[model samples]
Target: MKTCKEKALEWGISDRSVNNMCKTGKIPGVMKEKGVWKIPDDASRPVDKRVTSGKYIKRELQEEIKPLPIGISDYVRAQSEYYYVDKTLLIKEFLDQKPLVSLFTRPRRFGKTLNMDMLRVFFEISEENTAKYFVDKKIWRCGAEYRAHQGKYPVIFLTFKDVKFDTWEATLDKIRGLLQEEYGRHRELLTSDRLVEYEKEYFLKILNGNAGEVELTASLERLSKMLCTYYNRAPIIIIDEYDTPIQEGYSKDFYEEIIGFMRNFFSGAFKDNKNLSYGFLTGILRIAQESIFSGLNNLTVNSVMDEEYDNYFGFTETEVQALLEYYKVSEKKKELREWYDGYLFGNEDIYNPWSVINYISRGCIPQAYWVNTGKNEILEDVLKIATDDITEKLYSLLQGEKVVARIDQNVVYRSIAEDPANIYSLLLVAGYLKTPKKELQMDGSYLCEVSIPNREIAAVYKTEILSHLLQIGAITRTTANKIAESLFANDHSKLQKAIGEYMDKSISFYDAGAEGFYHGLVLGLIALMDNQYKITSNRESGDGRYDISMFPREARYPGIIMELKWQKDMDIESLDVLADEALDQIDDRRYDADMKNDGMKDILKFGIAFSGKRVSVKTNR
Candidate 1:
């Protein structure tokens, strides 16, 4: 029989992690005395018998990697009725040994904070009150020994996401408040009787918001040691959003100062404490060692390239189908698979578990939906950093050619200047773009051109931004329109790149299809034109169909009808073909059919063909 302490060594997991598993009945262990818990016999038995046996009582929930309305303490148990894929097995594999002291990583929404939360819920025991609420979930049904390990180890969980302090003092105070709050809850579990006076005064000083860094570090150390003494167990620690402070604080010196505190603070917790069991951490970026995690070692990083645990935090295909079946959303199986199911978390193809569940919960099939779960602060910086390269790509779009390149999904947050070869990689990794398909090449690269996909983003890029011309702060929308028209009528060549760059800067630029590209160019061209008329879509063109209609200032005679063509898809004579098509569409749909009604006579039309950077604009006879 191995004591709980010994199993921590054998498994190399944080004490809190092991404790959670044991509490949830995922591991085999038992309580022999009031203070002693032991794991006797076969330790491989699962907490959830159905999951371990490759069968689910609620057959449809095997895909729900994440379950139920989160943070609702009342709904603690893993709801077997809701879809939840077993990630414990995946995590058990990911943490085959002790993790590195610190790790920074970038994953899509489903991959970031949620994974960290899972780590926190699994590892920490000091806050067992929170864990107590989850004891009845599906995963805790049969593993009796696990239930025995409850209330054993001490754990600390801190998240950098909520940090909004502007000064070092403020930041330290915030951390102190958090630590004190946790300390206040488990003061009874601390057995540092020898340092009783020191700990009490430290807690008081922190409560008063006047704790010094030296004293703060010392207090945290005391808490760690006390937890060790009372529980007769080592401390386990997990941090969520570790890189948030550094990222949100970028270009600001306050960030580095705060980083200095956290770096030293965490190093002491994990390094100075010999009774420390293990640690697990998650954040968007792996800050360079020169700055973030200065002296800490012994961290085994599990990142995008680390494929061993790819399936640990994401939704798998099988899981998706199972969930659909469980929720009786089977009808949406194919649609969900196509839209939100294309992410890859290693070699395993994964889906957006969040989107899938949201759709199921709201009883709606997948659509453009709630992709805005994350704030675009970092995304804005990425855009500002990518102005030049993004501009070039926008120019390429005008040629009706979707830019293609090799991409490393993590390079979006990379510390390097924008490079031409890395654009696609940066975009795809940043979640602003995605690869619809991959074509492998003999040269050890992928022939993939990443692009935006969804009605919401589509409307954003082409509709709103395109409908108006950009302006300086002092320039009103009307004045901006005047300047834009003047710029267009005078010089379109320079204005083309200007609009491309502007669109890239201001919009969620898409890999516009042929029709989309043509409309984008038309909009750019119009931005430099006047704002005298409404920019309407599909007016009197057959039964509700027209690519676009640009009305000019005042009541003009014949409004312009700009027909379009992608010559490469057709032939060199396609211009003539488009010209003929425009004549027919214009006449049949009566494009000028309402000119008389509008107190106008003539009808203006243009046929445009775009190919590999050159645009041929011709007018109707």
Candidate 2:
């Protein structure tokens, strides 16, 4: 009997939050009011029994999960594990198995270190430990099975993530420092007969100025042997982002030295340490697998291509919905999906938690939010290697082909345009894109098209240059009005000419006569400007295709319709005939189908002609 607004208070949040939750596909609801709240006939959300751990939002803190005192760390901790995301559980499951070595390969910042830290907290035992900290979580509740195994193994975690090496010497110094720390921690086992062969050969050099490659390597071997001796079993070897140092290390002038030195250093500990436990090495690129890990035959590599635990990293649809409901930010779902919900990874329907969390926190889906946080080093790499064809295709994708196979994982540079999986991977990892859902292709391979995931990312490409309007410094209030005036002309040619000139100068010099380029340019122009900017789809006739389209995001600005021509083949009467032709399609193709639902009918005419690089614009009253 209650209205949507009245019922909203009972749900513990506002109407807007409920609506957004529905849109994000988080909490289910129906839109009863056009611009107001959705009246949820039933509010019970079904629990998701899928791969994600929590049915609701992911809570990061818990009281019983001990405040780990093992590291030189900061105290501004997150809510101590009230609920963990799927990635956390996956890592836990993997380590629970105690594999010899496991490597997690993801692009930068997919929570590699944080997940590593969770493993460090649970597995790595403290000497003066208490049984008090592990009680609240279910891991402890696994009862006698879990507790009996507690503190049973010595864990040695080496994090190369924070290590910065501008020079090979710096890298060597860091490695030596780590060795010294490890040796001091395991001094008792270092005295064992099995490991004693390394004290004179390895430690003597740390005391002296000269350390050989063999001695440095022998020290790691000695350490692994020591870990086995102390724990009475092999250690849990977890190496987080182990390959990052190599990637960053070589960008400097010392590539060969660092790689060669690192290869030898790691080969000792990783190349089958006799007294060793299993090990894990993670990094960005595989880094020539044969070159580093050498004979560590047990090493299992998990990159984006491997579908074993595809749902392990990114958020799933149910999780996304639950988070929206949890945060009460569900009112922004339609806005959220339009920008971010488009990437697909294998069979798992996942979303980027990083971007969505950021958007929901702000209460508005920003355009191109991911771009600001992403690394453009690959972008630089892409531009350098992009041939003319690749450049044109990127421009083509802008027009909405939902391109397949535009990227290849193996060929980082050349692969970006032909491999659909790799294209989304590059875009998602780079933060220039996101995974919205899982789409099963006819060919049996799933594909995720790159979309401007969230407003946090979409607002980047706006200019009269792209739409063909000349500007002074930036797109100001005056320029925006003038462009609106141009659109009001309803002359597709005028709008087309405007965009043609803009793209030729600002976008790319070689896109002349490229229909895909212009179509995308128009879409870019409409998407840019204030949300009120208008573009009427399929305006009018002889004007072909439906005439012109207008998008008015605000109430104050009048809509614009435009018709574009590749050449000047018509006189004024001919223009009218063409315009009439396009106007007819408006009704046939339902051009104004949705726009009319908003009640807007101010129409003008414009014809734009493009001749090579020349843009001739004309309008009719």
Looking at model 1, report the run of 10 residues with the lowest lDDT sum. 71-80
TM per candidate: 0.58, 0.60
Q: Each candidate: what lDDT?
A: 0.52, 0.52
Any runs in candidate 2 off by more than 4 Å, and if so which? Answer: 1-88, 95-99, 130-133, 146-148, 163-194, 200-222, 246-266, 284-297, 305-307, 310-346, 355-371, 383-401, 406-425, 428-621
**Model 2 lDDT per residue over 386-469, tens place:** 443444444334433343433333333234455433444455444444444435566544454454444344343232123333
Residue 146, model 2: Cα distance from true site in angstroms: 4.5
Displacement of the residue 93 alpha carbon in candidate 1, Å: 1.6
| Candidate 2 C-alpha error for residue 451, in Å | 5.0
